[model samples]
Target: MLRIITEPTEAKTELERISGRTQGGETLQQEAAVREILQAVKRVGDEALLDYTAKFDGQVLKAEQLRVSGSELDAAYHQVSREFVDAITLACRQIKAFHRQRMPKSWVQFGQDEIVLGKRYNAVDRAGLYVPGGRAAYPSTVLMNAIPAQVAQVPRIVMVTPPGEDGKVNPAVLVAAQEAGVSEIYRVGGAQAVAALAYGTKTLPKVDVITGPGNIYVTLAKKMVYGVVGIDSLAGPSEVLIIADQQAKAVHVAADLLAQAEHDPMAAAILLTTDETLAKQVKQEVEQQLRNHPRRLLTEKAIAHYGLIVVVDSLSRAAELSNLFAPEHLELEIAEPWDLLEQIRHAGAIFLGNSTPEAVGDYLAGPNHTLPTSGAARYASALGVETFMKHSSLIQYSPTALQKVSNAIETLAKAEGLHSHSESVRLRREMDNG
Candidate 1:
């Protein structure tokens, strides 16, 4: 059952204390393991990748067979039901539309004196997307990570995922990749796959950027390879914060909270409301809902560890407490959601009204589901086309324009005692005079 707190001071302290516990210590042994895997793959290339595939995944694959074939993708489309195909197609359209609207475009501005300054946006050469596989297969992740890169016009999009014991990639994942325009696929995963993408293997070329969610080893590998290749934000465990009021349904609030809790044992599910009765009702509903969930054990662990229900003095107080938590997903279950939107200063994604659930944003909603986790909502944003593109500022100054700023530049250079910097400007002035 979720814990309930009434006092404001107690609630704040409890939240902080629980959050600290959730951010637990790592094993130095785990770091050493990941480092060894990364270095081996970096040194031996495809040979090391094949060995790790057999050792970790229990499947041995040839270098040529690393990339999934077109026939396999075709078979995947046939294997899934028509309903699923239609759903995936619909999601693809929505995701593409949302990212297309936000696609960055190159721009140039010119002045009367022939001086031009602007920005040019270019997509990365290639991107590597890591999709988690095993008991659960998330085709949605493939679509979310690959579609934005496609929309950004990335020339090559490569996907890496662990193969099953049978040495076959998930058909649903493959189909989603094909639909989302992924040109390459690799049957490798974990820190070794991350290393291959960061520092090219013989079979897998290095990518300009890497994006997706994975286990702690994958997250740590991305952190270690920051300088070699760009990466999406270092995502932590999933989290959801729901702010409800007297008008909110207890069942709806509870269901949303459990949805996040089922993700992982470290995930957080929090509820803040002005009505004590509603908090009590939702707490009961959560227990009732947990009994029916298939992942009840995992959800129960998450709830017992990180979940909370706080009954605040007012809705304004609830929002204030929420901003401090900076949860990854925020749901406004109050009467006037838009009115309270201004009060929400920190959250990776916000779902408005009782009908708008966090699950909608996770799969079918147009917004990118790859979000900052833990308390990263304080600064980071959801993954989008911007994550796959680089921006370069353009500056052009004619002789007259250079002449206008030359004295200012020289004066600043002189103040710093850099005579050579001033001399460069003086040389230009003399050349123009001649």
Candidate 2:
């Protein structure tokens, strides 16, 4: 079902279209709907959350039942197998270890003139983690979002996920949350859940930052409430852009592409290679491998609409097209991956060589898998410890230091026609001089 295009111009067009897949053609309507949900939640609080949960999720819940019970979290361990618990524990340790390496420290710089300047970093008081529960319970998402907050030492990490038709949260999600140091779990989801985290209800405490990925409504809701609270990124569907060569195995490359396509019908998988033969083989392999796949219907739709293959003149050209695409996940399947890695300028996560696949990063590879999608890699980055923390500029200017720069500051402030700004500095200088 994958289409192969040799012409460079057509490849560029297809790549652009695929990279912008989350534009959501009906924007005004969707934005208005999300805005209404946010406003309703903001106005009426938990009542609105209950109403939307019942309407959208088809599961009616009361105020007291909004929070997942402590017994439920304990029973989650009993429901999952020992293997599941062990695997989740292993992933939790790996993710925590990875983020620990990225922890940033507060640093202060001293100058000869005694002008103290530094940056102080502190974790937000509370953080909200949203885990999607539509197609499947994404325990991986819980690990990815919660571990970063834990590494940042966020005081309180609260998780919100949609309950199923049975009015119960997924056992796997609860187990993963607990493993990631999050004890507070709420069973509300969709745009309304975003509202609760942003504005806070009587039962749910407001969070300083919200992280995780969801559907269109959840994405737009995050966008709407961005000013009220910080968010990881306006995450789009999963995507992968791979650059392969003649030596790259067709089966392996095809499997990696399908790995991304299986995420959603809008997910994109693109392949660029100098070898026309390899491109065609990968194309054929993708179709062959999709035969009777569990997610065939959705994967086929993704391939038919967003999948693409480009036969370039050289590996350099392939890298050029890849940088233009700015994919969320980039895999270099060339003979010398590091050699071509020099040409890479934009990508959220990079998988090197033929031995490494994007799947490793998705699981226990020790990197946050919640990466920027839909060409957002050009400006955004993967969710990490920085997402749940903020920094303030620490400044302390001694009287002598202020005197040294007072004239410059006063001149600049007066030139900008703000006397009050300069007067404050002028008074301090005059006090020390007098």
Candidate 3:
């Protein structure tokens, strides 16, 4: 059951406990396992990927079976309904339009002294996207990760997901990948898959950047392989903080909390409200709702450990607590949601009013749902077109432009005690004079 804490001190303590969910002795052991898998994949290549897939996923496959065949992608269309096709198509359109608006354009600025400087943005050569498969298939994840890379015009987008017991990728995920313009896919997953992308496997080529969410093993592998390649962010378990007022419906708030809790056993669902009566009602509603929930076991586990409700004095206090948590998803379930939005400072994504549920953003609200979690919203942002691309500083200086700045450059270099730096500038200036 969700506890209702009225004391500010107790509320803060609960917050600390939830925020530190993924830490401790358990995570240390998990990291060791992830490290071993990563090292084996690095050393053995395709042999390691197949070996681990057999052990973990209970599927045995050869090198050729690692890559999903084109026929499978084509057949996937027939498996899904026409409505699904249309829905995925609509999601792709919305996601593409949203990201296109944020596309970074390369530009060069020329100055009066023949000095040129600007930024040139270009997509990475190859990007690997990891989409979790098993208990749930996330076609939404496919669009979220691949659409941004598509907008960035990445040359190749490679996808990896765990195959089912039948040794086949989910049809919906395959269709979503095709819709998002990601043609290359491999039926490999877990830390070994991340290792294959970071380093190169005989079957799968190395990728420049990897973006997607996975289990603890996948997260650990990404953390370990940071400098080896680029990663979007070290994603953690999902979380949500709802700031509700008198107008907010108890059932709706309860549902939102459950939605987050159902994601993982460690997922956090918190509610901060001014109405003590409403808090009690929502807690009861959560209990009633979970009675028939399909994911009741894990969801109940999450709520029992990480769920919280704080009865604050005002909506401002709720927002303050929400900012402190820096939740991945923040919902303003208030009558004056727009007004309350100004008070919010740190949140990965904000859903305004009682109607705008976080699930909308999760499925197809056009905004990428792959957000910074575990308080990462305090510093980072949601994934977008920028994740797959890099920028280089474009610089050019004419001889006269060099002449004007040479003395300043030389003086600065001399101050830093770098003779060669000054000599290079002195030589350039001498050539101009000569």
Candidate 4:
């Protein structure tokens, strides 16, 4: 059952607790366990990956069978329906087009002193994509993570996913990977899979960056391996904070909340509304909808523990509480969504108007669905092409340019006690003068 709170102070306390759900003390044990998995993979490579797959995923895989075969990739298309293929193709095209617009270009600027300065953006040599597959198949995640890397022109895009107990990867996931231009995929997941991507197994190539969402073990592994390889973000569970006005439909709002809750038991769904009646209605509606939910036990646990509805004085107050939460998905079911959007400073993604739901963004909306969770939206953003690429500062100084700034450079270097630095500038100027 969803809880409804009318008191603002109580609502804030509950919101804070929910926002910090990922940082609970229990993670210390999980982190330690993840560390062992990482070390094991780093030390033994493919041998360790095979062991962990058997231990964690309940599937025994040979070193040779660790990588998904071309025959399986071809069969994935036949396994899935034409409707799924068509939908995935549409998502791939839409996602690729959107990311193409976001691709950062290398630029150079000629300054007053003929000093060339700019930034050069280049894709990493290889990128590893982690697609979670436990409760559901996330072909959308495949397209979301892989398409961005493809658009960024990452030379090699690799994917890794956990196989089912039958030791078969989801056909839909494989089809999505193919549509998104990810040809190299491995049949492995969990912390060990992350380590293999970061440190490289005999079968898996070392990648420059890893992107996607996963369970706690996967998230911990990504966090631990960040310095070894770039990561998209330490994504927490999925979350959504919706602000609904009187005009918003109670049933629609409740469905949106449940849509997020169904992702995981730790996922959160919240509502901040000025209408007390609507808040109560949504609360009732949430329970009503969950009665026959396909994922009832899992969604019920999420709703019972983390789901909340708060009745506030105004939309401004709702936005204030929302900013404090920094929700991963924010839906504005208000009459004037834009008016409230100005007050919202932080949110991973915002859905405006009653018709717009977070599901669209999760699937085919232009923006990336892999967003920051656990209040990370305050500082982080949705994963995109930028996650698979890096920039280098480009600088060039002509003789005249060096001469003009040599004295200042030498003074600054000497002040810092870097004699070689000062000498380098002075010698350059002297050589140019001669």
Residue 305 accuracy (lDDT) in model 4: 91
Q: How well is each residue in 1-434 modelled by candidate 2, as lDDT tens digits? A: 78999998999999999987777644788889999999999999999999999999998889999999999999999999999989989999898999999999999999867888999999999999999998988999999999999999999999999999899999989998998888899999999999999999999999999999999999889988999999999888899999998999999999999999999999999999888899889998998999979999999999999999999999999989999999999999988999999999999999999989998899888899999888889898999999999999999898899999999999999999999999999999999999
- Candidate 4 per-residue lDDT, tens place, 280-372, comes to 899888889998999999999999999999999999999999999999999999999999999999999999999999999999987999999
Task: Give the clashing pairs for model 2.
Answer: none
User: TM-scores of all models?
Assistant: 0.97, 0.98, 0.97, 0.98
Q: Can you tell me which runs of candidate 1 are displaced by over 4 Å?
A: 18-24
Global lDDT of model 1: 0.89
Clashing pairs in 3: none
Please say which candidate is ahead in lDDT: 1 or 3.
3
Weakest 10 consecutive residues of candidate 1 by summed lDDT: 17-26
Worst 10-residue lDDT window, candidate 4 = 22-31
For model 2, the local distance difference test gives 0.93
Local distance difference test scores for all models: 0.89, 0.93, 0.93, 0.93
lDDT of 1 by residue, 11-65 (tens): 9987776555535545789788889988998899999999988898898789998
Minimal lDDT window, size 10, model 3: 19-28
Q: Per-residue lDDT of 1-434 in model 3, one digit per residue for the tens?
A: 89999999899878877877776524668888998998898998999999999999999999999999999999999999999999999989998999999899999999978999999999999999999986699999999999999899998889999999899999999999999998899999999999999998989999999999998789889989999999999888899999998888999999999999999888999999999999999999999999999999999999999999999999888888888889999999998999998888899999998779999999888999999887889999999999998999999999999999999999999999999999999999998999
Report how far off residue 42 is in candidate 3 (Å): 1.7
Residue 254 C-alpha lDDT in model 3? 97
